[model samples]
Target: MTAIAVTIAGTDPTAGAGIQADLKTFSALGVYGATVMTALVAQNTTGVQGVHDVPAEFVRAQMRSVFTDLDVDAVKIGMLSRPETIRAVADGLAEFAARNIVLDPVMVAQSGDPLITPEAVATLRDTLLPMAMVITPNLPEAARLLDADPAGDEHAMLEQGRRLLDLGPEAVVIKGGHGTGAESVDLLVTQDEVVRLAAERIATRNTHGTGCTLSSAIAAGLATGAPLASAVRAAKDYLTAALAAADDLRIGHGQGPVHHFHALWPNLPGEKR
Candidate 1:
């Protein structure tokens, strides 16, 4: 049986983030990738120049087309630029009763561009968050979602994760990679338990699209029948290795991208300079 995962995100022409990165990550992890673009971004490793969000009706149409034709084992959502689009997506998921929905509440980009608006955040919390199977948010994003300052420590991260759980997702993964530290710790909190995944932070500039890749990988695992915790664990391991492997590949003049195919063709992991 083949596993399929859908990514609802913006399009990055550079292929470093958004739907392109999600698709590449899904393929590398052996899952069929499908996508519906919410916006078109003119961006690169360095920064984003502009964004053009797709109309809400068109977004709904694309989602309907996909769900109508495909089994859609799982869905990963990212970069929804407008509140209407977010509401539509939430409604569509409810209409289709799609399972294994992974929501990556993408508030800002690595380059510090605003991918989501203030109004859209409310929509995510009130509309989409309830329907998500799991929601993945980094420290900054979690803070924004919770409308509270992340205490800049593990304790705060845990609290914020728990707060997000109140919004209705089955689980919340508070990514700690964005925190200032030598170790990256991601806290996964569910109704049952809190699972922590920690890894030594790799000093690499090639970390673009990491969030998209990780969420999509988790979606892939879920689509293939892996339990939520197990799926997140697998995704963390894969992403850690991918980061280590591509720490040196210079894809662009600015911060480069993690080599998604590094596992397919193993070479030296990370740059020793």
Candidate 2:
């Protein structure tokens, strides 16, 4: 049987993030990928220029079309920019009783551009967080979800991870890429156990789709029937490798994208996606 993974996200023409990055990650991990677009973004490596949202009804229609025919193993959600879109996804997931939903609370872009509306934040917390099997949030996003300042230390990061778990996710992983350190550390907090995953920080400017790539990679793992801890560990490893290989294909001038096909094409020339 083919493992299937679906991504609900916005579009980035640069193919560095959002649906494009997600689908690429799924394929690279050997999972069949599907998509439902919530918004169309006009942007590049530098910053976001504009956004055009899809109707909530249409988004739901896309979900129904995919779920009805395919036995989706995992669903990866990103960039729900409106309250209506968030509600639509929540309702659709409920209909499917989605078990392996991985929620990436994507707020701002790597270029520091906001991708979601202020109204969607509360809706996302109250409506979608409970349905997620795992939620991946960076420090600032975690703070926004909890309505607190960004966690300044590791202790605070773990504490906030616990707090996010209280909101109903089975697990929460706090990504440490934004923090200052020689090694990047990620905290995976759950009701049963908390695992701290750390890796040597790779110095690279090609970090445009880091969050999207990691979350989608986790979804791919889950689609392959891997346990949550194992999935996260593997995803982190994949992200580190992708980041290291990011310079292999310098797509844009500002920030480059991770080489999702690095393992297969080790010496790929820098080509525009």
Number of the top-ranking candidate, with lDDT as the measure: 2
> What is the RMSD of candidate 1?
2.2
lDDT at residue 83 of model 2 (Cα atoms): 98
Q: Write candidate 1's Cα lDDT for 1-273 as tens digits.
A: 789999999988888889999999999989999888899999999988999999988888999999999899999999998899998888788888899999999988888889888898898888889899999999888888888886599988888998999999999999999888889999999989999999989889888899998999899999999999999999999889889977656677777788788778646556432
TM-score of each: 0.96, 0.97
Q: Which stretches of candidate 2 lie over 4 Å from their true place?
A: 268-273
What TM-score number comes out for model 1? 0.96
Question: What is the clash count for each candidate, in the order shown?
Answer: 0, 0
Error of 2 at 249 (Å): 1.5
User: Which candidate number has the best TM-score?
Assistant: 2
Candidate 1: C-alpha lDDT: 0.89
Q: In order, what is each prediction's RMSD in angstroms?
A: 2.2, 1.5
